[model samples]
Target: MTDSFQKRLNFDGNIDEVIERAANNYSLGNLKHSELMTVGLQDYNLHIITNQGEYVIKVFSKLRNVENIRRYVEIIKAALNAGVHHPSMLKDMKGEFIHTDEPSGLSMIVLEYIRGKTFYDMDRAPNSKELKLIAAETVKINKIKFKPSYLFDSWAVPNIHWMYKQVNKFLDDEGKNLAKTALSWYEALPIKLLPTCFVQGDIIKTNVVLGENSQIYIIDFAVSNIYPRVQELAVMSSNLMDNKKAPLLRRVERVKQAYLAAGGELTEVELKSLYNYAVCAVAMEFMGSYHERYVIGETADEISYWMQLGRQGLKEGLGEK
Candidate 1:
């Protein structure tokens, strides 16, 4: 097994024991078979097959703040009511979505297993139709009015400056130059004047799953927060436009048009700043992944992938392509 997989398996206690305790909190019948999903870097996701049905138990890292998890749950509930196709959070025996295992001091939540394949699982870019569906769903999420009390998220687009500061020193000279260019464009945007809303901040391919009947489900709201609404399209653009087979500008326009059709209104300032924000989003991912790989010692190959995309996004945004 690769080091990345080993890192994912490196939990504190017995895996079966932890699953049993967490599953006991739910009314889901006996856990027939459970497998650790090697998906995300931060959380330990278990694809558990219960006699009642299928469900996902997300065991959050100790580093995650409980308050943030609570806020994420609230945002998800609101998003669901607004017709966003997100997996339903399952309430535990105590009528709460978050269940704390007293022994491990780890917080876990059960969600209805989305029966589909994430773009990551397919290892391909979302097609134009899928991109439009993603844009429409994002509009539904941004339309949510309930804002969490905590609005400061390191991964939010507005915080790119802060993230840049944290990761620039670790970046090489070429990486630094690309990041600086993206930052310069980001700095020129009228961020304060742009419309703000609760955005599904991370709209990357991995967080989007193509479900049965072509329904698209957005998962993993760990980075969602209130931000300039345009950041939604920006994040989507950065991820979707990475495909070299299609013209980047065409993909960008498609998502923008879809968002507008789905009741999203972008101001003139936001329109001009969209590309800049998308580039900054790429820089953020690059730097953040660099930090994880170099500083935190994560051996995931995704760091190099982000670096490659960051180079492309920065050059394209600067008209250097």
Candidate 2:
């Protein structure tokens, strides 16, 4: 739901109201300093430094309702229980997980602030040991199960034809032709239906934090959903590939080896199919994010960059030139 190039959307509501609510709900002794973080692409995150401790007050978009808010909180709690590194939510005075500001009409959640730095800021990829840790943690996270709500389960089973349609919508004639060719390969995959598990659907580097204790923390499960375990590999492949600057096959091989070494299982066919789907996943994200920005007469450097890499991945996946 967030584009790389899109400007940070801020909350139209008064910051004071949100701060007061957090201060009251979380029992922060006094408000020392409140800073609006411009890093978030989707939500307005306010870093509140109070006399008691630091906290992050996330004001969600109007698109999220009360029920959805509760579901998100539930999923995070479940992930934490399964040993995933993420901040725990702080409940309000009424013992409510979700808080709604009547004036802003936007829902908010306060979380315990963890002192860390995101991978994006570090400007480097995870080493082999770190990769294994990430893979192991992901395996544990998938085991934490929940019944998927109707709205939350759709991403589990992706529709290739629908993706082609979406990709075609924003591309020029030549670009559409390239996408069509790539998607044909994705359509031909014999993807086995694996058991659905809890996945942190978006595992981009920016969403990961390395704590002061050298512990790797995976944050931002806002995109979490029930999906075939292999689907997690699809997203991981995209993250590891890093738009093709890194050695794609080597990185994937190492990651897969580490994952299996950590007691994770994947059939040969499933691995191949997921790598193919990984290309399609990149195309789908391009259409949804940068392409949407492109069609509207905006800068599309990111879209063009990813398209070059995705096209290559698709070709390799299909054994075609």
Candidate 3:
């Protein structure tokens, strides 16, 4: 493993300086430094504490191009205004997403930090009844009446094919083979079998926070886009599979039933393709692991566990019978 990675926190200053910049952007007073907690990626993550309160500063790696940051902020804003629960809020100091005159040559976005433990821990799964509630809330979010921003008409655009290219380009021979296998599996599946909608894209335990007042908040819309509901479901199911006691397949079925009960529309083809989507999703994680984890190094997340869960979902999603 590369001992030293081009990680975050190249600020070249102490938290006090960061607070100065933040205060200027948010138009706040001098912020005292609080203990910064590291989560998600490798660096650029700090939980600053001032006399006022706590806020999260997530410095984006160059991987997050200008367009990507802009689209994410805009989408999250839309989701919030549309009555969808999400992290605190974010605003771009500059006009939309533009090239920051930074040496890194990447655009940076600032969001109000929302604090909470990641929901991905194995113990985070709700009881049987609570799962139903989670499903209902998810359906309600999907039903939120709203329109997508014109800036990104094609949210899921760089399609799976493009994703494959990304995987192949970075991975070694073994990784490339994994990517190819994943590609063929997804290609073999009929798109018509999967229901379509705006998937949470990168739904994982950490992304969903169980907030105070018994509220559930889903944050991080960077990977979000309009895609097959099954695709999203598969990915979510795989996420839930971290618990060995609670098999991911069972959770998926329960979530599906709950989603349907909560007004999630599903067709025969869509329902059937759910399994395929799950399996293919696992392959995707495996193939993309290089770029996401190894190549990106510490900056990337650990999505390796989801690979097996996704494969398991393939069979379970196909049909329990």
> Going through the candidates in order, what is the number of backbone clashes in each?
0, 0, 6
Tell me which residue pairs clash in candidate 2: none
Question: Higher-lDDT candidate among 2 and 3?
Answer: 2
Comparing 1 with 2 on lDDT, the higher-scoring candidate is: 1
Off by over 4 Å in 3: 1-16, 35-37, 41-43, 90-115, 121-124, 144-184, 192-195, 299-321
TM-scores for every candidate against the unseen true structure: 0.91, 0.83, 0.74
lDDT of 2 by residue, 1-321 (tens): 223222332354456766786687667668898877655345667788988999988877555666777777888888877778788888887888787766655678888887887765565667777777788877787777675464542223365565556447656775576567656766676754555667787776667777888787888777777766767767666654363455445556666777788888887677766656666665555444434354433343443444565555544543432
Q: Report the poorest 10 consecutive residues by lDDT, candidate 1.
A: 1-10
TM-score of 2: 0.83
- Candidate 3 structure lDDT: 0.56
lDDT agreement with native, every candidate: 0.77, 0.65, 0.56
lDDT against true structure, model 2: 0.65
> Per-residue lDDT for 219-288 in model 1, tens only?
8877777788878887787775467554445556777888898778888988877766776777777777
- The residue pairs found clashing in candidate 3 are 32-50, 34-49, 120-205, 193-269, 193-270, 275-317
Best by lDDT: 1
Shift in Å, residue 194, candidate 1:
0.9
